[model samples]
Target: MSDQTGSAGVVLKYTVSPDDFTRAGEASSKVKNILKQMGISPDVIRKVSIAMYEGEINMVIHAHGGEITVTITPQEVLMELKDVGPGIEDVEKAMKAGYSTAPEQVRALGFGAGMGLPNMQGCTDEMKVETELGVGTTITMSVHMEDK
Candidate 1:
């Protein structure tokens, strides 16, 4: 793989629209394609892609949309998603594997299985979630790359 043995850092940014199921995965797809082009190992690419997609979907469904920024380097890939919606009330409960607060409409759409944060945590090397009740939430995640 041409994993850019000594390349400089690359940064990618995307805006996720609220409740836009039609376009939900666009940003994550773009990132996955870019990672493939960069020759990132498939394993790392899969982890980053899954984690970021989950975060993106969460923003679309819960956060009234948000912004995602991805920074890639030889050592790791870092993702940050920020949103300005009604913040999560209980982060501890939200981290549970099947706990979800999504409304029935969203569930009818088959979008909210309450697995987003859990899947993200499982896929990333490191993850963080910061939120305030009336303010917003920001999630940051990273995936470490294998030695080239």
Candidate 2:
């Protein structure tokens, strides 16, 4: 998707494809590049990259693809991931390290170590998850920009 800028902020939109491990990190990479080009602080860039990458991978592995919208402003970066796949059953359990519901096949790929949510939380200043058992899930994360 094309990037857009408006009074609200600079918005970047991407579509994560299911089971596409080879292309999974494209969005995060693009965002990182944009942040770098914008001269954002390295710390904030690093945090946003890690959190967005983890969320993108989760969408690919569990959610069967989704949409990622990132809004960058002077104060903070906001990332929203929305998917229509099977929703998370337990948010708490999912947040725990080494606890995962990913299938054996997914684990074989060296992913699904159950660190996705935890790592995302660790990197972002704020995060929120909304899910329904059979419906879908949406995760919103934010990393506040710090004064240099």
Can you tell me which runs of candidate 1 are displaced by over 4 Å? 1-8
> How does candidate 2 score on lDDT?
0.94
Against the unseen true structure, what C-alpha lDDT does each candidate score? 0.89, 0.94
Instruction: Name the top lDDT candidate.
Output: 2
TM, every model: 0.92, 0.97
Stretches of model 2 off by over 4 angstroms after superposition: none
lDDT of 2 by residue, 28-115 (tens): 9999999999999999999999999999999999988999999998899999999998999989999999999989998998889999
108-145: candidate 1 lDDT, tens digit per residue: 98868889899999999899999999899999999999
Model 2 residue 35 lDDT? 100
